[model samples]
Target: MFECFLEIGFEAELNTKEDPELMEIAYEQCKENVATRATAITELRKMIFARGECHPLRTDDEYLLRFLRAREFIVPRAHKLMVRYCTFREQNKHLYEGVDLWGLVKVKDAYEGTMLDRPDTGRLSVFRFGRWDPNEFPVEDLVRAGMAMTEIGLRQPKLQILAGTVIVDLEGISYRHVATLTPTVAYQIVCLMGVAIPGRIKGVHIINYSWILNTFFYLFKKFIPQEAWQYIHFHGSDLKSLHKHLDLEVLPERYGGTYRGVSSFGIWLNKIKKYRDEQFDREMKQLGYVIKE
Candidate 1:
């Protein structure tokens, strides 16, 4: 449901100039255009796709590639603005309500490390929603949740060692965060850096589509061959909606723990393992991987 044009415009601006004044104006214009059109464009795309007519944007791969390309332009601009703004505020020692810019950079670095590449601007698009508000910040929630997972040792690689007693708090975190965090903490750190901090600190919405797409891409990049990159896509809705629709039954019984009538990380991890196993199995059937089972 994302638009390619806005992304293209943003990208064009990013590549066209280096002057701070021009960059700021171009970035603001692109941001405004994207923001103004986001909802309508998304809905239109969905409607067109739903009608079963050959939607111009047919696949998630195409959408993601275009989105990433566009973000490559816009994200740097946003990052620069964020850095400047945050520095100014910090220098004045003014109290800011939202996420910290330095925190976002750290998180983005961590995220890129986990993914082995810089996160595209599309991935950091959540910051455009509003002025960064710490109270509404998903980064804090994710950090807290992640810390909790670590505290309970649910984040450990081995699930069978511990029964299903570990509880995962799903409240106050976004679905995008859920997808990223459920992986290794390293991956979670990447997502946290790219999406969560920016969203909180900059008061930008940083479209959830970017997070979902990046998460899939990050996983695929790590576990699959480069030739197979086309298979990855953002699978679901924005973070909040994703959490709402999560199904617990798909996970392994060993990992499934009751948390508000749903599965915890204990269960979620099992599902991820199963997903990996299925992908591996498919790859083995087709390509015959050399690794010993």
Candidate 2:
């Protein structure tokens, strides 16, 4: 288990001010407390070294806080999640092959269903899969694109604290698109969403549902865990129902909102591109990502 090692200097100074409302949510929902945060992070880091499995990881408080928040501050569960995250990365190295900020932004179509310009309650992120051209972009590229989005999302401290919501628009989905998701591929997607990623997904709103999607879910629900299933919702072309879960003001016109601007993938790509800086590049390298200049 200790084939390679990276020693992290664990520090006791883990105090960073957060909004009072968000702090309340973190304490009430995720068991996070400024008072005990340093202790929890220290314990989590110690467990990582003691287990000797999750080597070469980002042991900094900000990074470790993601897992702690995701697991509601349980050190053992956070440790398991960290191990699962590293294991998933190792086993599915192909999915992350070219997942870099600059490179990913160039793949314009990859951002089709994404809504990142502004966030809904708690930084809601959306992806519309119905518009994706499986013929032009392989499903593997879709996974890689999603990985890039997750990497960027992890960088936002507010997102980690408030958590996020996902909206999967299936407006024009076809059988051809559903066929691309093999059982193995579906399982991997589920693992990436439910297990690997160290962010809390409060709700997953599925709009524009079709029999095709219904049939697909019936077949693939086995791959989804029970807890994740609770988050799954079906809106079926009713924007009103979707609005109940997310803010109608934040949704684009296509989703029956008043916002009159293009929310295309390219726009989001450029937005996140401008978000990069020296610190962003260093953090990406720490996570073992290659940044294409």
Whose TM-score is greatest here? Answer: 2
RMSD of each: 22.0, 8.8
lDDT of 2 by residue, 22-102 (tens): 777778767898899999999999999999887745798888988999899999999998998888888887776445556
lDDT, candidate 2, at 58: 72
Kindly list the per-residue Cα lDDT of model 1 for residues 1-293, writing each as its tens digit: 12344333223321211233333333442332334334433543454456543323123322322222222324333333234333433332212223232222222211110100111111111111122233444444334333222212211111101111111212233444444434344444333322212221111112234333454345424533343234223323344432232223321222231222222233322322333344333422332122233
The list of candidate 2 runs beyond 4 A from truth reads 1-21, 98-100, 106-120, 259-262
User: How far off is residue 176 in model 2, in Å?
Assistant: 1.9
Tell me, by lDDT, which candidate is best: 2
Report the error of model 1 at residue 194, Å.
17
Going through the candidates in the order shown, the clash numbers are 22, 1
TM-score, per-candidate, Cα-based:
0.19, 0.83
